[model samples]
Target: MYEDFASTLAATMWTDFDETPEREGPTAEITDIDSFVIDGNFPWTIITLETDQGVTGIGEAYPSPGVHEIVTDYLRPVLVGENPLDVERLYNLMRESLSGRGSQWGVGTIAISGVEIALWDAAGKILDQPIYQLLGGKTRDEVRVYADCHAGEAMVSSAEEGQEETTYEPEAYARAARLAVEDGFDAVKFDLDVPSGRDIDTLSRHFDPPEIEHKRSVVEAVTEEVGDDAEVAVDLHWNFSPETAERLCEAIEPYDLAWVEDPLPPENTDAMRELKRSTNVTLLTGENRYGRHGFRDLIEEQAVDFLAPDVPKTGGIAETKKIADMAEAYYQALIPHNIGSPVATVATAHVGATVPNFVALEYHAREVPWWDDLVARDDPLIQNGRLTVPDGPGLGIELDWDVVDEHRKTRS
Candidate 1:
């Protein structure tokens, strides 16, 4: 099925190089390619590359419409005849091709992310090694995973095991926290900004008094409910001003929350730094950051205590590792924001295995019942709320084609 699809987009991507005898040697030329946009928690654009040697590597770009065109129209022509094992060389092409045109963020990074990851996957297979070995080696047998359980989604609030619905009361948060705790997760994150009805309305400079109290209740409920069983974190999603964020951070300081994520939008690091100074709460940020260059200042200034780059969105394996390494130098942890499918999750895990500063990878699809079915595995991919880094090869997971086709979005 993949071969047939690859044959169509790949016919021209694979330029016949019989004329260029000097350019020969160990080239695992790309033979076929296909991309899928599956509608899940977010629109996930997944890419697959088939080599002349019958090795098909899977990769994913963070959700973007331009990724399809970039992969097919821009990158295919340059990458088809190139050696898949020349991971660094191919990655340079992905970057330099758009150098003068600015390929650091948006569609540029997303496109490069897909191509760069596929190159690494192919390189791992050709070397007969796990992706982690290719990156360096394992730092841990399993990567700790944190569940993003919140009341904004269907959850277990009552005795009925399968019951699920969105409710944002303090008790609702407590129920969600208990649900995550019972499932063997020792670390949990909750969306604290949305529960207060006044948040979106009072966007100017500060939160109303009632709003502050409501937000505090949500945090305390989750922390009190989970107690010592699990460490708790809250995500602001950049919905607060520095003044408001400062107050909120001070309010939640006594609860012992793991960190306050993106209390304000990252447009101004100075403001974020001020927020950092204002609170005792650890700051975790940069899920929307694109590449290593985008993270340099964040790491250099020590604006945040943890860097959470979404794997697929933050330039895939190499770039994310670079960002993680940068954060490590500043004694910051790289937790990695993730809302992607199994492919991206495991790809991030291989990275999690290598980075010394890796804290825990996020598992955000607790509500998607078919999330596990997307991968071909006999046992569960996630065990006790942690993902055991697979030694198989590449990302160490295969997409369940039947399941993907069913949820695939028609546009891409």
Candidate 2:
């Protein structure tokens, strides 16, 4: 079945290339391709495939510009003529070939994510089953999802910023958080930062003042309205001084946050370990991270209670699962980061299916209304705050190619 689908996909992509010759080129072409933006206007590259079996799959290359080029110019040749159903082998080939290119981070991993997801999507079509079926079957019918209202258009630029910085008022966040629970989500996440200073002493207050107080107030409001049944997580965004992380954790302890994410920068395992020592609240890390090795040092140091690597950033599905498994051994839960498109959410769901230690997955739904237009799906993989992994083959969603071309952004 995959054989037919691969042939079909190859032929269709060729037709797409021929019809839209301007869109074809090596990954380098991506350098010339325009950046594709939507809703929150986060730039992304959409990896699409039209299978011979009359099915299509979509994947995402996110958080970076020019990632499509990485997929097209850097990884396409290896992938174009290959079996889309051979998801694991194809992923390994890319990993081995691009080992030197921050194999588990940045553009390289993001590119791999696109290809891997495309393959998964293709396979699902081939087998007439969802991607999760290929990953040791689903452990649960519905994967739990958390509403991520931390910062939507507030932090990112939907339109160009003017002279002054945007003020994301506390009430705006509180409103977003409260609405998330009202919208039937069981959990919500918000953004917090470590304090910054002109000098070292001022650093102690990095997580202080307006940001801290404002954030705390937001969490408290949401927690109060939603009560104990609801969960809340704080994304520190890795701006913390270790001392500040510990201090902030103490301050937010009463809220009973589901976890405090990325208390320290990804590189400082020692700082994370130290912060964990004094804090009893749950610690989360790994979204700004990479492969199993990215978590190895942190795991070895016993730094966190939850490992939240984005599959796209951590060498795609398989690699992120490997990291999740490692975390499981250490009694840690794997709550993946899903700030990208629906394609990424599906890819991450496949991994969450196989990992027993899985907790909840992030769904930045506030912007979903805008981003959903990018995909062609009858029913969202998620419903009623739980993602129901499509039982159909490969990431199980189709791409509206017209949308990609419409939103394309070129930089080079």
Candidate 3:
């Protein structure tokens, strides 16, 4: 009896050790596209791709006007009957289709981002792997997150009366950074490029001495308040002309920013290349850029210190990774531009984990108190300025239907 029991135990050990779960092959066709417009301060255009095999995938595109129309009117017809697992092929086909409208840069790309992201989610689910696993596995267990703290009053509707207003004064900025630090975040970003203490014109590129001083003081206060506890970065929102941008970059150099983001608009790569040559300070941009092709010149020209692709805005998971791959070849850091809810944050993190030259990912949902509550997870999605890549299948977390049902917007 003892011999038989030992033999059985040994067999069980061998069975457990010798085999692992394998992903299912592509077999299901995409059946339908269901979407929602979660309108609040900013709209979240969420898409759900359904497969015939009872599997579904969730994805998000960055907030923009008329994304709903773009998705339903253009992309749905292309995706409905295709093999849900043919992610990259579908991505290319969509690009081809949109060539008539415009090249991959604006609302068309944003619409494709949502659809392509859903394909990855569907692929992950069909393969029984996390999105990161499908992307050739991750280099790290967690992706570092930076809080995108804003200074201006949020464009909240009158319905959101309970929501708080945020300001951009030196003291207020300091306090906001401290709050982020206390909440287990090691990095914080603030928008320092607002019409404050100055009036401006596009005809002439100039900033007043007091306005420049006010911006300088804002950075000083934040850096001082955070001290050695957390790193600081600031956004200029592509608000300045090249000449004015260089002056601002020089003025803010002493604060040791993680980056000074998008000082000039992304209209010209030659201009960005010139700006990079002028600053030893880490300059980052690319949230407005489309696919890998769109970012090619920026990387090849050594235009910026770091690349900041908004994964959901750029071209979804696969294209964003392709952009990072190019940036890695040039030895640059990738700080993904994130302004959506948890869906985009986690999707971007999956890509961040796979990239060799990733720096940090942005987290801009700080203003929405109930942002974390939208998804069902055992623990908080972000802690101590990093998010542990989820281990489950697909995006690894499901949208809480109850939460989405409460805040969904109705179109007239």
- What is candidate 3's lDDT per residue for 303-390, written digit by digit as tens? 9999999988899999999998898898988999988878888899899888889989998777677777788865789988889998
lDDT of 3 at 220: 97
Model 2 bad stretches (over 4 Å)? 1-40, 49-57, 152-170, 194-214, 378-381, 401-412
Candidate 1 lDDT by residue in tens digits, 227-313: 999999998888888888888888889999888888998778788877787789999999888889888888898888898998888
Where does the lowest 10-residue lDDT sum fall in candidate 1? 12-21
Flag regions of model 1 displaced more than 4 Å: 1-26, 100-102, 154-166, 198-200
- How does model 1 score by TM-score? 0.90
**Backbone clash count for every predicted candidate, in the order shown:** 1, 22, 0
CA-only RMSD, every prediction: 4.7, 8.7, 11.9
lDDT tens digits by residue: candidate 2, 326-353 = 8877888889888777777878888888
TM-score of candidate 2 to 2 decimals: 0.80
Error of 2 at 30 (Å): 20
Q: What TM-score would you give candidate 3 relative to the actual structure?
A: 0.89
